[model samples]
Target: MREVRNKWVFKKVKVDVFRVVRRVEELMRELNDDMSVAGEQEVCSEGGGRWLRPEVGWVKLNVDAGVKEGWGLGIGAVCRDSEGAMLWGMTEHRCATLEPSMAEAEAILVYMNKARRRGCSRIVVESDCKVLIDALQLKTKGRSDFYLLLDDIYSICNDFEIVL
Candidate 1:
């Protein structure tokens, strides 16, 4: 009778432990879901909506950049018309590694230059990097490492009617 009682208690403890573990896993999943939803909402609000269509007679140039730890950086851009049709797209890999922000700045510079070479006069430049946009708009000449790149971008802006 004593042996049976001990076995029953052990089984009950094991089941309870598993139940607690299952609850923890469920909570973690819920937390991750909530975080992802929040992130999506933030992006939507910042981006002004999904797939922004450019104004009439203007081409939308969207640029993005990514950095790998040991590897260098990759930059890409897509130019689309008001009808949401892709006009041009390009991707370039930089052999020199850089910080994420610098990589983003480089992407804008490269894309704008390419567009200019392609004779795109009127463009709406779009980037997810709000900091870079704000800096460009405000003309903030800080002593950061991106200052030179920002200057170059401003200079490049002179070649076209650019709307950020």
Candidate 2:
């Protein structure tokens, strides 16, 4: 009876290993396809435009947010002058669980507040978040959970001569 149980356990372990290997292979293939598509898109878009420096005497504040499952969000910003010299950079991690859009809004709010505190009067804000940018541009108060954050961003914008 003990020998039979050992054989059954060994077979189960082998089957589980095979299933894990197959799943990993499938995931690898999917990732490879995604990389290829992203590479092609980058090549196509490279000729469209490039990142230009801010105007003379103005500093650009670029902000971005990163989110991970089971981990909170991270917000980062960098201030650079027209000569491409870094004036300042900051990063902060928040313990709250937030969606991507909300995290982006939070990043913008944090960076703008930091810039204000640093006495940045003439600033150009740049972000890859089109939704947040559009909301700020149109002054649209979104109905989502980010409404308060968006409002805060709008209020902060009034503090500086901002070019979005």
Candidate 3:
């Protein structure tokens, strides 16, 4: 019985690892593509406190993640130019139960991937989740389980100028 259980766990782990590898490959391909996706990438100049614009030639991407008990996670990103005008925006819903920090980090990775896919030149990313920011900035060790996401974020950052 114990052996059977171990085999089942191993199978699950293998499948999860495969999915992650496939995802990383997909992101790499997206980054290499030069064509930008057509649509709204920015927003108006109104924002609450804590919103700041990046320098000229650099766009600021603000991302947030929210999770509702029993409901799943929602993540979004908005890009603003030096004039505080939005250039584009995106939102995503993920169905998974992970730690808040992990969820936030995942959301950030999602948006970073999007920006890379769009062939952004330079970007400053803003996030309210300190844990994710700290991890991205290498200020904290972060949870080991989600280190893959951090690694992916770092790799994505290499494709262009990124400020966290």
Candidate 4:
């Protein structure tokens, strides 16, 4: 998808113009929606969203995961440095359907592990799931049924400096 946009694939040819345009437009919308740097807010700060940069030397990891009925789960993340240069991005499909919070928590934990391995000492991780975000912010895991998963996430988080 990045290749189609970044490499100017559209500029190379114009095929079935209207169909191509509509397809590209739909793809654009999906990508923008997938970026999900901020939830329930505009894409820019002036419009009340928060796709802001991290401090220099820090990487901002934007993550999101979703569970679709009968379709299992999808998890993805993109990491960009303070300069807005792409460090990495990934998407995965899990065949098993899982609870939403569990899937989101698992996604973030996986992203953090990858980021730490990528040598990102300081990171600002962003996610659209308010439940997971709120859970991570609290000092304790609480008495939720998924507390053990939360515990695992917190332990992995200790490997680096993290920003909510």
Clashes of each: 0, 0, 6, 0
What's the distance in Å from true for residue 58, model 1?
0.5
lDDT for each residue of candidate 1 in 1-164, tens digit (9 for 90 to 100): 22332554455333354765577467545544543565432223222466556777889899998777666788999897765556778888789888888888999999999999998989999888888999888877967779889999999999999898
Candidate lDDT values, in order = 0.77, 0.75, 0.70, 0.75
Residue 137 error, candidate 4, Å: 0.9
Q: Is candidate 1 or candidate 2 better by TM-score?
A: 1
Instruction: Show model 1 residue runs off by greater than 4 Å.
Output: 1-49
Residue 159 lDDT (model 4)? 88
The whole-model C-alpha lDDT of candidate 1 against the native structure comes to 0.77
Write candidate 2's Cα lDDT for 30-101 as tens digits. Answer: 544544565432222122444456788888898988776665888888787765556887888788798888
| Structural similarity to truth (TM-score) of each candidate | 0.69, 0.68, 0.67, 0.70
Return the candidate ranking by TM-score, descending.
4, 1, 2, 3
Give lDDT tens digits, candidate 3, residues 59-154: 888888777667688788877676655577777777878788878888778887888788787999888888788878883444587787787788
lDDT of 3 at 92: 77
TM-score of 4: 0.70
What's the lDDT for residue 145 in model 2?
74
Better of 2 and 3 by lDDT: 2
What TM-score does prediction 3 earn?
0.67
